[model samples]
Target: MKNARPLPSYLVQRYHGWKATTHAENKAWYRRLAEEGQRPRAMIISCCDSRIHVTSIFGADEGEFFIHRNIAGLVPPYAPDGDHHGTSAALEYAVTVLKVANLLVVGHSNCGGIRGCHDMCAGLAPQLEEKTSFIGRWMDLLRPSYERQAGIADETERLRAMEKEAVLVSIENLMTFPFVQAAVESESLTLHGLWNDIGEGVVECYDPDSARFLPV
Candidate 1:
């Protein structure tokens, strides 16, 4: 706490601008949200990449979504091992307490986490393979995905596939939670996978029918 400093000058200026315009305009809505508490309709798990903005992409308003962002937007399989589990805890709260109707995992193109996992699996990134690296351990969840796409001869296509595969892998891992599986089976909750191309402004949803990601 001692190391913390005041807000940057630009951020302070921007905050004042937002407070004068956006916040002022939506004062009643903000007040109502504060009073009512959140009852989000969906939980979106997305990459930590600053470029991927779930609300902006979905044209959503505040309180409409419960979002969790992490590297590669990965979700680990359910493990109640007493240690800290941020993503899993979020998922549990979303499904059980919040009772969200939908759970979505959004992956994106040029994901540094995915690329690192790919390279690490291929013996190309020794730093990521280090035992002390938290990212390396987190990315180990995607090793199976990397193995599946490692044989692709084209690098571009392979990375793209890995990005989408990350979404699918997360979705698969989500099912490993008993509560999630029960909710899904009882029609109380639904799971979705999506991939976005950052530069192209294109979004795609996984089509389980064809096992492909088609434009959304």
Candidate 2:
């Protein structure tokens, strides 16, 4: 018996439509990308949520932005570990090799990873064990934020605060890398924080002047 779920009919149909669209543009653009190489002007770090597509959200085309997707869009502080550093490796490639001029950390509302962190911290989920899953380990990166907000009594406010705080934490971690820090100090690279409200179809940007998130 097959345990795999069948593909949705709509998805199958969409694939054919995507093929036709891509085929028309692939010859010209794909070859150019291969020959000229990717010179994307920005690097975006976003969540792996299917609903939060960075390319579609930003109306970006292929080879336009170097994107790295991870659980909760979290960026851990720089640490030289032998284990795979998926997000950090992508950052190094984009900044050091591709030399992208901008880096944007896009955080979205109602992120499952963020929700998981909140749930786990509230004792609504199981404790981490030796066999802790990948998500559990990834959410560990947000422990500091969770700890800081532990005293909050309101669940809704806590989640919202955690979501935004997580983005700030990632930006802080980005600076831990020597290359990223040097670029920022030299004004060669700029960092941006964006919040996407998936339900409302609204985008909020971090306003440094107001020190708050304002709709954009």
Candidate 3:
């Protein structure tokens, strides 16, 4: 019995149930989306953290949002020669092709990439250099913020500040894309900065009025 083939019972059952219900209730909707392609209303630039799910957090259904996830949700400034521009490419597709009305940069608390960048920049992780990893390169985007915030006495405060600064930087980088800039200037699209603190299940939006992340 132990050697007998095991089927993915839970997943298979759940998928079958979902498929039946969705096909019954949303067959037309699904067909229309498939034929016409997705016309998502918003584009979310977020971290690859498994806990930070944009769809679940926003209560959005399929085809509602175009999402781009990267390390620490960092968006590199427009560079002509940067070969690894996955985030930029996704942004272009969302803005130019999908024509999303809103672009959101969602940063989260307890971000591992942000913490790694902070530690590496502050010389707290000297052993990290031995490993030739993409994380080191990806976190390079936050180097400037790390340098500026290095003097903060409290590690916790410094990490928080870096996280916020990283979001602001990504927003600025988003403008570096010509399509994004044109969309914003033409009033066809709006940019937003959001922070999700998972531990407390608290979400904060960057309030331009006070330039602070306030609970939503």
Query: How many residue pairs clash in all the candidates, one count each?
Result: 0, 0, 0
Q: Residues 132-188, candidate 3: write the lDDT tens digits.
A: 758887788889998899899998999999998899999999899888999999999
* Tens-digit per-residue lDDT, 1-216, candidate 2: 588898999999999888788856587888898999999999999999899988887799889999999988988989877888999899999989999999999898888888898887777767642255778878988988988988888988888888888898999999999999999999989999888889998888888899898898
lDDT of 2: 0.88
Q: Name the regions of candidate 3 deviating beyond 4 angstroms.
A: 1-10, 127-131
Tens-place lDDT digits, model 1, residues 1-216? 899999999999999999999999999999999998999999999999999999999999999999999999999998999999999999999999999999999999999999899889989999988899999999999898888997999988998999998899899899999999999999999999999999999999999999999999
Ranking by lDDT: 1, 3, 2
**What is the RMSD, in Å, between candidate 3 and the native fold over all Cα?**
3.8
Q: In model 2, which regions exceed 4 Å deviation? A: 1-16, 127-131
The superposed Cα distance between candidate 1 and the true structure at residue 38, in angstroms, equals 0.4
TM-score between candidate 1 and the true structure: 0.98
Best by TM-score: 1
Residue 88, candidate 1: C-alpha displacement in angstroms: 0.4
